[model samples]
Target: MTDSGAVLPWLVIREDDNGNRYRVGRYATRTEAEQVADRLGARAHERLYVVERVDRATA
Candidate 1:
């Protein structure tokens, strides 16, 4: 859970050099999500990792 004690809504997304994007995972805090992205990015420099809040409107 996040500091605010809410459901995890932040999402980690990976975008490849080929222009493909997909969700990696969800975290309660942005910091946690970023850390995961950083680790993934370090292992695969060819792909790009990013963190974003879940868009309930689109869901």
Candidate 2:
């Protein structure tokens, strides 16, 4: 759960050295790449959004 009181969807965002970007969505697992995708979808561009999950960190 996130601070917003909603189930926090783990997401990712990536930026190429050239400044190109893309978004992949609704993954059952989370990763840095997935979070990058979500961030890109949310902020860098106006497009259809999707939800994904991040891997639970293991201690």
Candidate 3:
């Protein structure tokens, strides 16, 4: 933590059966990320996650 005090962007990702993380997409808002996560979860047979991605702006 570099004390940037910035809100990072969100990402929607899927962890397949092979334990590989694949980015479904990136969103500017958490709501958008969660929406995509819901859609993917419905069809996903493996793990799905909505997580914050460290933005370059903060770096």
Best-performing candidate as measured by lDDT: 1
Candidate 1 has a TM-score of 0.80
Winner on lDDT (1 vs 3): 1
Q: Cα lDDT for residue 2, model 3?
A: 29
lDDT of 3 by residue, 21-51 (tens): 8777767678878888998798767676656
Count of clashing residue pairs in every prediction = 0, 13, 0
Give the best candidate by TM-score: 1
What order do candidates take by lDDT, descending?
Answer: 1, 3, 2
Residue lDDT tens for model 2, 1-59: 44555544554434455665444433334564456555665765435344445444620
**RMSD (Å) of each candidate, 1 decimal:** 4.0, 8.2, 5.9
Residue-wise C-alpha lDDT for candidate 1, range 6-35, written one tens digit per residue: 678899999999999999998888999999
The lDDT values for all models are: 0.88, 0.47, 0.71
The Cα error of candidate 1 at residue 45, in Å, is: 3.1
- Report the lDDT of model 2 for residue 51: 43
Winner on TM-score (2 vs 3): 3
Q: Give the CA lDDT, 0 to 100, for residue 14 in model 3.
A: 82
